[model samples]
Target chain A: MGKVINGLDIESLSSLLDEARKNKELVQKISKWYARVRWAGTGFTFNSYVRNHSFTISEPSELGGPDKGPNAVEYVISALGACYLTGFILNATKRGVNIKNLEIALEGEIDNILVFLGISNEGHPGYRKVIAKAYVEADCDEKTLKEIWEETVRTSPVGNTLARNVEIVPQLSLIK
Target chain B: MATVVNGIKLEDFNALHEELKRNAEFVSKIHKWNARIRWAGSGFNFTSYVRNHKFTISEPSDIGGADSGPSAHELILTALGACYSTGFIYNATKRNIQIKNFEVAIEGEIDDILVFFGLSDKGHPGYKKIVVKAYVEADADEKTIKEIWEAAVKGSPVGNTLQRGVEIVPQVSLVRK
Candidate 1:
C-alpha cells in the first residue's frame, strides 16, 4: 500500500500529476461551475444549490433576516479561505511534503456597505481588501512551506478571480 | 410582525436604513466579515466556519475528493447568487414592487482547470467570465423590474467584488503539532 499524508494518497496523486504533465490536451480544457439561488419565502433568506449540495443563506436580524445561516458576504470569505487551503494542500503534497495540519482564517472588508443598502452611492459596494492567515504544521522546512504557499496563492483560481476583474454578463427574464 | 414584502420586514429595514443615513460614523466605519477553514480528516475535505454556521467543502472524485460538498468555485457562485437575490429583494421591497417569485442562476467559466491542477501555467486559473440570469415574477412592469435587477447586480457586494480588483494579503505561519 502507498503512503497517505493528510488523508491523501501520495502515489495516486503523483501518478495523476505525471499524466497531466505529459498530456497537453488534458490540461488545456476549461471547466464551468454553476449555482442557483431561490428566495425561501422568509426575511431575506435564500436556498442556494451547487452540484448536489444545498444550503440556506440568510441575513442577520439587524439586516431584517431570521438569521437562518451565514450571509452572502460571509460565504464569499469562506470560499476564499477554503480555496486557499485546497491550493496549499495540493501544492505541498505534490512537492513531497506531508502536512500535519492546515487552517486558514480570512477577513474581507467591504469599502462601503452603504452603497449596498442604497443609503449612499458614493463608494463601491465591493470588498476593498481581504486578509488570509494560514497556520500550517507540516514535515517540511519553513522556506519550502512558504514557497508552496506563495505558489498556491498565485495559482489559486478563487484568489485570482477575486484579485482581478472578471467580465460579468447579466440577463434578466421577467415573468408576468 | 410588521408588514412583510418579498420576505423582508419592510418597517424594520426602512428604520435601519434611515438610521444609517443619519449616522455618518456608522456608515463610514469599515465592516469586516470573517470565515475560517480547517482541513478535514479525509481527502480534500474541509470544514468551513462563518460566524456560528459551518459546512463541508470538498472536490469531486475525479479531483481527489469524496464529493461530500460543493467545491470552492461553486461556493463563489452561490455567494454571488445569494448576494444578488438579497439586493433584488431589498430593492423591490423599497420600491413596493410585489414579487411572486425570484431566482438567480449563476454560471462561471474558469479559463483553464490545468492551472488549478498545477499542470500548466499558460493561462490564468481564475474565472474568465461569469454569466448571471435572473428570473423574476412580479406585479410590476417589465421595465421597472429590469431596472431593479440591474440595480441589484450593480449594488451586490459579491458581484462587485468579482467584477472589480481587490487586494489580497497573505500571512503564513508554521505551527508546531
Candidate 2:
C-alpha cells in the first residue's frame, strides 16, 4: 500500500498526475459540471439536484421561507470553502506533508440586498468580498504550509472562478 | 386572508420591503453568510456546515473519492441555480404573475482540470463559462416574463458573484502538534 496522508491516496494521485503529464490530450480536455433546481411550491424554497445527490435550498423565516436548509448564498460560500480545502489537502499530500487535521471557515458579504429586492439599483446584488481562514495542523513547517496554501488558492477552480469575471449566458423559455 | 402568489406570502414580502425602504440602515448594512468545512479523513471527502445544516462533499470515484456526494464544482452550479430560481420566483410573485411551473438548469465548463490536479498550468482551473436556462410556465406575456427573467438574472446573488470579480482574502493558521 502506498502512503496515505490526510485521507488522500498520494500514490494514486501521483499516478494520475503522471498519466496527465504523459498524455497531452488529457490536459487539453475540458470537464463540465451541471445542476438543476426547481421551485418547491413554497416561499423562496427550492430543490436542487446534482448528479445523484439532492438537497433543499431555502431562505430563513424572515425571508418568507420555512428555513428548511441554508440559503443559496450560504451554499456558495460553503462550496468555495470545500473547494479550497480540497485543493489544499491534495497539494499538501503531493508534497508529502502529513496533515493531522484541517478546517476552512469562510465568510461572504453581499454588496447589496436592496437591488435584489427591487427597492433600489444603487449597487449590484452580489458578494463584495469573501474571506477564508484555514486552520491546519500538520507535521510540516509554517513556511512550507503557507506556500502550499498559496499554491492551493492559486490553482483552486472555485477560487479562480470567483476571483475573476466569467461569462454567464442566460436562456429563457416561457410556457404560456 | 393574506395574498399568496406563487407560494410566496405577498403581504409579508411587501411588508419586509417597505420596512427596508423605511430603514436605509438595513439596506446599507452588508449581509454576510458563513460556511465551514472539515476534512473527513477520507479521499477528498468533507463535512460542510452552513448555518445549522450539514452535508457531505466528495469528488467522483474517478478522482480518488468514494463518490458519496457531489463535488465542489457541482455544488457551485447547484447554488447558482437555486439562487437564480429564488430570484425569479420573488420577482414573479411581486409582479402578481402566477407561475405554474419553473425550473433552472445550470451548466459550467472548466478551463482545464489538469491545473487542479497540478499536472499542468496551461490555463486556469476555474470555469471558463456558465450557461443558465430557465423554463417557466406563467400567466404573464412572453415579453414580460423575459423581462422578469432578465431582472432575476441581474439581481441574482450567485449569478452576479459568478459574473463579476470579487475580493478573496485567505489566511492560514498553523497548528503545531
Candidate 3:
C-alpha cells in the first residue's frame, strides 16, 4: 500500500544480507525445516517470490530447465522485473510521481548451449547475454519518466547484480 | 555498472514470514502443482536430469508433465514461489506456528507485442500483470489462518514486490567497437 524511500535507504534490505552473513544456524534450520530446501553452497543470498500454481514446469521445455524447476535465467529476468517494479514504486513514493497505471515488460536473450551444459565459464550459459526491456506509462512527461526509470534501475538490487559482474566470497567453507 | 548489496536480518526475515503466514491462499495452491521447465538459453539443469530419462521427482505417482520443459513464466513463478516457500517455511518452522499444508501460487501474463511489432523499448509494454494467490491448509482454524495469510502478502518478499511498482534504469557507455 505504501513505500518508504530515501534514495539510498537500503538498510532494510541490508538486514537480509546480514541474515545471509549469519546463515550458519539458519541454513541448517532451513534444511531441516524442509528437506526440499537444500543449500548448494556458501554465501547464502535471499531472492524470494511466490510459486506459480498454474502449469507444471519441468525439464527441456522452453526456459532450458529440466523437468524439475525453472532455469536460473528466467528467474533472473523475474528478479529483474520484480526488482525494477519495486524500485519504481519506492521511487515513485519518494518522488511523489503520482500519475496512474504502470506496466513493465522484461525479457533476456541467452545462448542455448551454455545454459544446457551448465558450464558458463563466463556466467549464464544458454543466454550469453540477456536484455530487459520495460515500458512505462505515467502522468509525467516522457523525459521525467525516462529519468525516473533510469534511477530505478540504478538502484535496483537485482538489476545492479545483473548489470555488474559479481565475485562471490564464501564465508562458510563446505566439506566438499 | 553500479553495484548494490542487500542483507537480510532476523527481523526482516520474520517480517517476511509474517506476511506469508497471513496470505494462506497463495501458500496452499502452489504446493499442489508442479512444472516441467527447460532452460532455453544455453544448457539444461536438474530438471533435465529427470526429463532426459534419468531420475524421479517424487514418488512414481509423483505428478509430472508428459513433455518436459517449462515456459518462461512457469520457471519464474517456481523460483519466486520456491524462495517464498523456503523463506516462509524456514521462518514459520522456526516460530513453531505451523500446522499442516501450505502453498504459493503465482500467475503471470506476458506480452511479446513489442517483439511481434519489432518495436524498441527497454521493457515490454504488453505484459499487463502477474497475480499471486497464496493458499494455506493448517490446523489453526480459519481466523488465525486468515490473519497469517494477510501478514504473508503484506510482508513476503515476492508479494511486496508484486504489490509495489517496478522502476527501470537505462544507461549508456561508450566503448570502442
Local error of candidate 3 at residue B36 (angstroms):
19
Model 1 over residues B93-161: C-alpha lDDT tens digits?
889887989898999998877887777788888998999899998889988998898889889999889
Candidate 1 chain A has its poorest 10 consecutive residues by lDDT at: A22-31
Q: Which stretches in model 3 have alpha-carbon errors above 4 Å? A: A1-69, A112-115, A118-126, A169-176, B1-177
Off by over 4 Å in 2: A22-30, B28-30
- Which window of 10 residues has the lowest lDDT sum in candidate 3 chain B? B56-65
lDDT of candidate 3 over B8-89, digit per residue (tens):
2345444544544555554333212111222121111112221233211110001111222332223444544544443344
Sort order, TM-score high to low: 2, 1, 3
Models ranked on DockQ: 1, 2, 3
| Candidate 3 structure quality by residue, lDDT tens digits, A110-170 | 3322212222233222223334555444466666667666766655544443443322111
Query: Model 1, retained fraction of real contacts?
Result: 0.88
Q: Which portions of model 1 miss their true places by more than 4 Å?
A: A18-30, B24-30
In model 2, what lDDT does residue B177 have?
Answer: 60
